[model samples]
Target: MSALEAVIPTPQVIERLPGASFKPLAPAYVRIPKPKPELQQEAIRIADLLKRNHGLDFQVAVGGTEQPGDIRLEVAPVAGVPTGKEAESYALTVQNGQLTISAPRMRGWYYAAQTLTQILLRSPEVPACRIRDWAAYPIRSLHVDAARKYFPKSWFIRQIDRLATLKINQLQWHFSENEGFRLESKKHPEILSKSYISRQEATEIIAYAQDNHVEIVPAFDMPGHLGWLLRNHPEFRAGEGEYLTRMLDYSNPVAVAFLKELIDEFSSLFIGQTQTWMVGGDEVFPMEWIPKELAKRTPQLSEYAKRNLGPKAEVLDGYMYFLCEIDEYLRLKGFSETRAWSDLLYITNLMNLPPRMQIAYWTQWSELMPSTQKLLERGHQLLNVSDRYFYYVISNRDDCAYKKHVEATEILRNYEPQVFSEKYPSPVAQARVLGSSYAIWCDTPETEDYEQITRGIWPGMAAMSQKTWNPSVKVLDEEGFMSQLYLLAKRV
Candidate 1:
C-alpha cells in the first residue's frame, strides 16, 4: 500500500521516497531525544510503547534539554491562523534514518504523535514516509452521554487516550440532562446525587485531556429535557402538567434565577479552560414549548403552555429570555462563545437573536430539522452534526442493545461536512461552520455494565474523521478506505 493510505483522515500530502527508512530503535536501546520534564511523559510514553512493540529498552531519565536529532519534536507558532487548520497543522519527515514532526503548538505535537503512532504500528521496523497534514474542521469532537451511564474516571481517561490516537481533538462532556446530572455543583449539590462526576474528578479529566491535546467542553442540558432535575424541585418545572417529562420553567423568575445560579456554578468550574459551553436549549416542545407527553394523551391548550403563553413574540419571550442571560453570563465568565441546539432558533422567527450565540447544529438527514441555509442566514455559527452522518442514534428503550441499530459506517461513508458550505450564501457565512461532532445517547439498561455503548461509534468514528478531514469523500477510492479500516481494526 502507498504511504497515503496508511493514515486515516488521509493526510493531505504523502510522498514516498524509495530506499528511505526510519529505524526507530537499536537492538539494545534507542538513544531517544530528551523532552523537557513537563513533556517527558510523552517522550517516555512513545518510547515505552516502541520498546514493548519492537523490543527495546529506554534508559529512564527525567530532565534534559531538547534539540534536533534522530527524532525531533517541536512547538512552533503560526500567528493569526483563523483558518482553523494551521494551528494544528504539522509536517512529518522520515528520511535518512531520521524522523521529525513539527507543529505549531502542544496540541499539534500531540496530533503529530498520533500520526506517528499509526505509522509505527504499520511499519515499526523501517518506516518510509513524508507527509504534511491538517484537519478540515477546527473542532472534531465526540459527545459522550456520561450523565446517563455514570462512566468511571478510568473509563473516560482510556477513551481520551483512544480519541487522541485517532487525531480527534475535542471531547464534549455531556454531563447532564434527562436521567441524571453528572456534574458537581456546590450550589446545586442535588444534581450530583449520584456523584457521577465530582469537581475534583472533573479537574483530573481536564488535565489528562489537555496533556493529550484534547479539549473537554463541559455541558448540562437546560430549559428543556430537565431529566430528574425538576422531579425533586417542582419549582423549576415548566407550567403545571401531569406529564413526568419536565423542563425548566422559564416563565418563573425564580426558576430562571435557579438556572442562572446553576449555570454560574458549572461555568465557574469550566471557565478559562474552553471557549464554548453547551447550554442545551434543544428538543423543547416547539409549538407550545410544553411536554409532548401530555399532548400524546391530553388535547388541551391552557392545560400546558406553562403560564408563559401568547402570540409568537410572547411564546419566544420566556425561552429566549433565559438564553440571553445564559449567553451573557458565559461570555463574562471567560467563555468566548456558547453553543446550543439549532432548534433554539426555531421557536421564534429568526428576526433577532444574540449574535454571539453559536450552534451545535444538526438535522435528521432525511428530515432536516433546522434549515441549514436559514440558520446560516440568521447569522449563527455552526458545529454541524447531520444526524444522518454524526448521530449514532439508538432506541432510548432500556433494553435496546444494538439489536436493530443502523451501522453508522453506511451513512458516514457517503456523508461529508463540506456540504454545509452550500447552505451558506457567502464565504463569510460559510466560515461560520466551526466543526462537527458525533454523539451516542444511552441505549442500554441502567444496570448493564456498558459493553455495548461504543458498538455504533467505533468504526464510524474513523469514517467521520475521514469525511471531515478529507471533505471530498467521492474522490477517495473504496479500496483505500477498506484498507484504512483494515489497518485501524488491528490497533483498535
Candidate 2:
C-alpha cells in the first residue's frame, strides 16, 4: 500500500479523537542549524510553552545540517535554510526514539512549525510515531467585513491569531462601504475624514492583522455605493446634490477624478507584496435618478431607454459606465484583483474587467443562481458568500430563545444544502468557487456585545467554516458543535 493510504485513519478510530482531547508528544528536543532571528524566536517560544505547560524540557538546539526525522515537533535541523522562497519542501520524522524536522527553506520551516502546533493541539494522544503532512489549499482564507460594521482592532487581531492556529492563510478585509468608509484616503481627504469616525484607527487594525500571519485584502465600494463619499463631499453627489444624498454624479468628470485620486491613495496606504484591492460593485438602487439626470442633459439620451419601459434603462447604463471607469482606474493603479457583489454580473457585463479581476458572489437574494453562473462563464474567479447560511446578523434577539427567530433558524437549517449541495448545481457555468465567507453585519449589534452575537451564530458559522474548509466534511450536529464552540471561544 502507498504511504498515504497506510496513514489514513479508519472512521471508527477518527471518531475517538475529539478536538479537545488532542495533545502533543512530550519530552522532545528541537534542532535548527543556523536559524534566523524569527525561527529562533519561534523555537524558544515553543520550548518555553512546553516547559511551562507540560513540565517537559523541550530542548532546542542549533546544530550542523541533517535530514529531518518523522515526529510531531520538528525544529529546523539544517544549515543553509532558505528564507522567503515559495514552494519549498520540509520533512519531519519520529523513528527509533529520535525526532527530527528539517526544511530547505524558512517558509517551509514556518509551515512545518504550524503543522507541529496543530498536531500537538488537535490529536487525542501524543503523536509518538512517525507522520508526515503538508498544506492542501495554498490560499486558505477567512474574511471579515468591517466596512459594514467596525470591529475593534484587538478583537480583529485576536481572531487572526486564532485563524493562524487553524492554519488559515488569508484574511480578506472589507474596508469600505456605503454605510461608512473605514480607511484613510489622503488624496481625497473628504472620503474618510468626513465619513469615518477615525482613519488612524483603521490603519492600526491593518498593521495588527499583518502581524498575525494574515494577508489583508482591503475592499472599497465604488460606483453604486458611493453614498458615504457623496455624503461627505456634496460635489460628488448627483445634482439636488445635498450632503447625505444616496447617489453620486457619475457623469461628472470632477467626481471621476476624485474617485481616481481616492483609489490611488488607498493603493499607497496598503502598499505590500501580498495585498489585494477589492473594489465593490454592488446594489445600485434608485436607477430612476441616474436616467433622469441623463435625459435632462441630452434629450436624445432617451433613445437608450428603448429596451425598457421607462428611463430606468438609461440610468442603469450610466451606472454600468461608472463601474467600468472605476475598474479601469484600479487597473491603471496596478491592482489586479477587484471584487463586487454578484449582482454586477446581471446589471452590467463585467466584460471590461481586467483578466485578474475576481467577483465575490454575495448570494443574499434568492435568484442569484443565474448571476453566479454567468460570472463563471465570463472567466472570473468567484467567492461564495450565501447570506442564508453564512450571514451572522440574522440571529435570535437577546430576549428571544434561539428557536424564536423563525427566519434565522430557517436560514441556518437550509443554508448548507442550498449553497454547497450537488443537488443545487452551481449557477456559474465554469464553477470557479474560490471559497466562502460568513458576513457578521452588526446593524442591531450596536452595543458591541459580541458575546451574544457570537453565541447565537456559533453553530451555524462553525458549519459554514467546515463547509468552506472541506466540502466533504460531514455536517455536524448543532448541540455537539455548540459544546465545542464554547470551548473554542474561551481560548479566543
Candidate 3:
C-alpha cells in the first residue's frame, strides 16, 4: 500500500519523493525549536507514540542542530501554509533521509505526529513523501451522552485516546439528562445521582484531554431533561400538578434564578477549559408538550409569554423566549458561542436566537424541524450532528430502542459532513458549517458493555474524522481501512 493509504484520515496532498525511504534509527531524537511547555508536550507525545508503536526509543530534545535521521517539529508562518482558524494545517516532508513537520500551531504538529505514527506503523521505512494536510471543518467532534448512562472515568480517557489517534479534536460531554446528572453538583447536592463523575475526576479528565490536544465542550442540558434536578427541587417544574413535567417552569422567578445560578456554578469548572458550551433545547415538550389549551392548562406559560414575549404570544413563543434568555446569559458569562439541539428553533419561524448561538442540526425526521437552508438563511452557524450519519445509539439487537444501530461500515464508505439530514437532503455550505460531530447516545447503557460500545463506534468515529478532515480526498476502501486499523490498534 502507498504511504497515503497508511493513514486513517488521508492527507490532503501527498506526492512521492524521488529518494530512498526514510527510516528511524534506535534512540531517535524528536527536536523542537524550544522547550516551551506546549512544544515539550507535543515532542513527548510523538516520542511516546514512536516507542509504543515501533518499540523505537525516541528522546525528546530542544534546539538540536541538523542530524541525518531525526524528526523535527516547528510552528511558524510558512508562506503557503494556512493561517487563522485553519492553522491546524501542517506540511510533512520526508527528504534527504530526514523528516520534518511544520505548521502554524501546536494542534497541527499534534496531528502531524499522529499521521507520522500511522505511516511508521505500516513500516519502519516510510516512503519518501510530501504531505500537506488541513481539516475541511474547524470543529470535528465526538459527543457522548454521559448523563442517561454513567460511563466510568476510564471510559472517557480511553475514548479521548482514540479520538486523538483519529485526529478528532473536540469531545462534547453531555453530562446531564432526565435520568441523571453526571457531574458532581455541590450547589444542589440533592440532584446528584447514585453514580456521577466528581469535580476532581472531571478536573483530571479535562487535563488529560488537554494533554491529548482535545477540548472538552461541557454540556449541561437545561430547562428540559431535568428529571433528576426537578425530583430534588419540584418548584422548578414548568406546570402545576403533583407530578407535572420535569421541564423548568420558566414562569417561576425562582426557577429561572435557580437555573442561572446553577449555570454560573457549573461554568466555574469549565471557565478556562473551553469557550463553547451546550444548553440542550431538544425534546423540551414531548408530544403534546406544547399544551393546546395553554391559557387553561399552563396559565403560567401563557402569562410568561405575554409578560416577556409580547402580548398575544403563545406557549411556543414562551419557549423560544426562555432559550434566548439562556443564550444571552451565556454570552454575558464570556462564552463566545452557545449550542443547543435543533428541535425548537426549527419548529418556529421566529429568528430570535442570536447568531452567537450555534445550532446542532441532528435530525429532520419530523416535518416541524426546518430545512438546513432555512437555518443557514437565519444566519445561525450549524454543527452537523445529523442523526442519519453521525448518531450511534447503543443497542444489542436489530430492533434497537432509540434508532437502528449506526451503519459504521457504510458511513466509512459514503458519508460526508454536509449531509445534514436523510429526509430533507440539502448539502450545507462549507463556510456556514462549523464542522461535524459524531454523537454516542447511550439510551440503554446496560445493553452493551463499555468495550462493546467502543468497538461499535470506532469505525464511525474514524470515518467521521476522515470525512470532516478532507471529504474530497480518496481513501482506502473499508477492507483496507480495517487492515490499517488493526495494525494500529494499540497505538494510543
What does the lDDT read for residue 469 in candidate 1?
71
Off by over 4 Å in 2: 1-30, 33-61, 64-93, 97-125, 129-142, 185-204, 239-244, 286-318, 348-351, 364-370, 394-424, 427-431, 445-448, 453-461, 475-484
The number of the candidate with the highest lDDT is 3
Expressed as tens digits, the lDDT of each residue in 1-492 for candidate 1 is: 554466677777777766557665443322224446645566556565445434555543443442222456655543333465787787777766566666675566656656766666666544566677777778778988777668888878877766776778888888776777777777777666465777898889888887777888876777777857876787667555533246776656787788778877777667666888888877665434233433443323222233434433334444566676777877888887788877646544523557677777665322324566666666777886656556665455655433344454564555656454234323334467777787766644353454455444666776667767756444346566666666655554
**Which residues of candidate 3, in runs, are more than 4 Å off?**
78-85, 240-244, 287-296, 396-403
Give a tens-digit lDDT track for model 3, residues 1-492.
Answer: 665676988887887888876788876788999879978988888788667667888788897685766899878643454445456888888887788889888888888888888887767677788888888788889999898888899999989888988888899998878778889978887888899999999999999998888999988887788777888887778765532466888789889999888888888788787889998887776545444644567778788888886776877777888888888888788787999888767455543777778899887766766677877777888898877778788755667645675665777667777778736576877788898899998876798788888887887788888888888876656677877877766565
Who wins the TM-score comparison?
3
Task: Report how far off residue 464 is in candidate 3 (Å).
Answer: 1.2
Superposition TM-score, candidate 1 onto the true structure: 0.82
Candidate 2, 105-192: lDDT as tens digits: 4445544554444344333333333333333223445556566565666666666655554445566676666666666665656555
TM-score of 2: 0.70
Model 3 RMSD in angstroms: 2.2
Clashes of 3: 1
Cα lDDT of candidate 3 equals 0.80
